[model samples]
Target: MTGIDFALNHMAAPRLGLADFFALARSLGVSAVEIRNDIAGTAIADGTPPGDVERMADRAGLAIASINALALFDDWTAERAAQAGALIDYAAACGAGGIVLCPRNDAASAAASGDERAAALREALAALKPMLERAGIAGFVEPLGFAGCALRSKRAAVEAIRDVDGAKAFALVHDTFHHHLAGEGELFPEMTGLVHVSGVVDASIGADGLRDAHRVLVDAGDVLDTVGQVRALGAGGYRGPVSFEPFAPEVHRSPDIQAALRDSMAFISGGVARPAA
Candidate 1:
C-alpha cells in the first residue's frame, strides 16, 4: 500500500458539529483535520472556547492541522493584522499546528502589476512572521488559482517568503484544485504544509467557469488529476496531510458521507499505488 497520509477538512462535513466532526475524522482513521473560520455556526464562529476545541480533539485522537484561513492576507492592513493575531491566538490555543493565509482574490487586487503584487505579498509576510514565531505556529499560505487572485503563483509566493526570511514561519498549501486551476507546472513539495484535495467531474465546465459549488469528492472521474497530483507530491518528498476539501453542497449534505469519503480514500490510495504507465 502507498504511504498516503489522509486528513479531513471540516468542509468535508460542514454540517456536522465539532464533536461529530472530530468523531467522523477518527472513524475514517484520519488523525488530522483542518477547521475553518468561515463556516457559520461552527467552532470558531460560534465562539467555541479554544480549550474545548483542544479537549474535543484530544478525546478523538485528532490533530488540528490548521484553522482554514485569514482571507485577504496579502492586502495587509491594521484590521488584517488584528484578524491574523486573533486567528493565530486561537490556533495556538486550540493546539493547531498552523493557520492558512489566503491572498485577496478580487479584481482590484488582481489588476495590480506583478511586481506590485509580489511586493505587497512580501510586506505582508514580513509583518506576519514575528507574530507566527511568537505563537509557535506556521502560516500556510494558500495561493488561489482564480484569475482575480492577487497571488496566483506558488513560485511567486515562495519567492516572497524567502525575500522576507519567513521560511520558518510560512509554508505553502498545494491544493489540487487550485494547482489545476492555476495551470501551474511546478510543485514545491518540500515547502508544502498541507494539501487540499477536491474533484470536479463536470466535463463541460471550463477552468474559468469552475466554482466551489462544483467541487465534489475525488473519484475515478475526477478531472483535476488529484491522484496524479498526490503521487507527484509524494514522489517529491511531501509526506504531509492530504486533506479532503470538497465544497459542493451535495457533498456537505451527503446522507452517507462516511461511505463516500471511504470510497474516495480507497480510490486515491489504489491509484497512487499503481505503477505509472
Candidate 2:
C-alpha cells in the first residue's frame, strides 16, 4: 500500500523547536509535517504572514500540509476580511495545498445556534473562495465537535460548502476524537481533505472541560477508534495524511518521542478498520 502523508501537528511537541520538529518527524515515520502557527512559539494567530512560516517549513524539509484556519474568519467584516486575507497569503507561502477554516465558537450573545453560525460562515466561505482559488489553494473546513463549535460534522460542513461558486473550493477535515465526541458513529471520508488522528486514552474529565491536550495515538479498544477512523478515510477516497495531533500532556512530556511515534504507526497500520465486535 502507498504510504499516506502523515503530518504531525506542532502542538504535539510543546517545547520542541522547528528544527527539533523536523528531526522528530523524520525519525518517527511520519510522511510530512504541518506547522500550526498559534502553537509555534509566537504570535502567529494575530496574523503572522506566509513568508515567515514558509521559511520555517522550508528549512525543516517538511512539506507544508495545511495552514490552520482559526478565529472569526467567517464574520465577513472588514477587519475579519483583512485577517482572513492575511492567512490566505500565509498558506500560499507555506506551499500548503489549502488553509483549514474552523467555524466560530458559539456565544451567549448574537451568534445564535450552530446552524445560524454556519449560515454566516457559509457566506464568509463564499467570499473567501475567490481568494483561495486565486492563490491556487483549496480551503479545508473543519467542524469542531465541542458544544461551543458551530459546525460539528462533515455532513454539516459539506452542506454549507455545497452551493458555493467554487464547490471544490474546500473539503472537510476529520479528526477521529472529534467524530466520537460529536457522536459521528460512522465514517464518510469522501468529503475529507485531511485526517487528523489522535487518541483520547483518558476516561476522566467531563466533556465540557475536555480540550485537545489529551490526544495520543491508536491502540486496541480505543474510545475514539483512531485506527478504524483512519482506515475509513482511506476507504472514502481520501488518500491524505493520517496525521498525529496529540495535544496530550503526557505525549509531550515523554523523553522517547520517537519510540512513541514508531509504536503509534505500527498500531495504526496493523489495527485500522477492524469490524466492530
Candidate 3:
C-alpha cells in the first residue's frame, strides 16, 4: 500500500456552515473537500451562488473535490438532465473537480430489468459525458451497495462508462461502507475518482441490516474492514483522497468534532499498510 492521503466530507460535520466546514478541513490539514447541496441555509441550498462558493473556498484555501451528488442519476429523465446540467454548471462555476452521481436505491428501482437498467445507465452516461467534458469536470458515478440500489457494483459502473466511451469524463466513487454492504469482491481503483471512508462498528446488526445511520469513524471495533479496503485501493494504484463521510448522529452531534475527526484520521492512517520501498 502507498501512503494514504485524507480529505474531509461535509457530512462528517453537517452542522457547520460552508466557511466553517472549510475551516474544519484546513484545521485537519486536509486541503480538499466535498460539499453538500442538501443542507439548508448553506451555500447551494440557500442559493448562495456558485461564484460565492468558489470565492469562499478560495479564501479558505480549499479545493472543492465535488458537489456531494446528483441523486437518482441513472434513470436519466429530462428532469434529471436539467438537474445534472444545473449541478454541472455549479461545479464548473465553483471550480469543483467533479459531481458525485448517486443511483436510485429503492425497491422500485430494484424491480427494473437488468437489461433495462444497463441500457438506461449507458444512455445517461452518453448524454452526460459531453456536458461534463465541455465543462472540464469528471462525473463520479457511485454505485450503492444496498440491495435496493439500481447499480450496486463498481464493475457495473465501469462497464457502463466503457460502453459510453466516457473514460475521460467519468470515474467511480469507491465507498468502503457501500462496498461492505455490496458483498462484491471487485475493486476498480484505477477507475476511481474518490474514496468515501466510514465504518460500521455495530456488531448487533448484520451487514444486510446496516444503514447509513450506522456509519461512523473507523476504529478497533469497525466490522467493515475499512483499513483493508484502503490497503486494497492503495495497492491497486489508487492515490486519491480517502474522504471521511460518517453519517452517524453521534458524529454529527460531536461536541468536539475537530478532536473526533483527528482521532478517526489517526486510526485510518495507522491501520492501512504502506507499500514497500
Best by lDDT: 1
Compose the digit string of candidate 3's lDDT tens values, residues 1-277: 5467789989998899999999999999987999988888877888989999899999988999999899999888899999999999999999999999999987778899999889889989999999999999999999988888999999999998998899999999999999999998999989999999999888999878999999998888999988989988898999998899999999899999999889988888877764422
TM values, all candidates: 0.98, 0.87, 0.97
**Model 3 poorest ten-residue lDDT run:** 268-277
Indicate the residue-level lDDT of 162 in model 3. Answer: 91
lDDT against the true structure, per candidate, is: 0.93, 0.72, 0.91
In candidate 2, how many Å is residue 117 off?
Answer: 2.2
Candidate 1 ranges with C-alpha deviation above 4 Å? none
Ranking by lDDT: 1, 3, 2
Per-residue lDDT of 1-277 in model 2, one digit per residue for the tens? Answer: 2345667876667578766777787777565776666764542544546676667666766777776665656667888788778778777776887777876665731347656676787788889889888888888887777876767777777777886755678877898878877777656577777878888766776556667876675666466767767776776677877777787888889888778777877778766545434
lDDT of 3 at 260: 87
**lDDT agreement of model 2 with the native:** 0.72
Off by over 4 Å in 2: 40-60, 109-111, 204-209, 273-277
Of 1 and 2, the candidate ahead on lDDT is 1
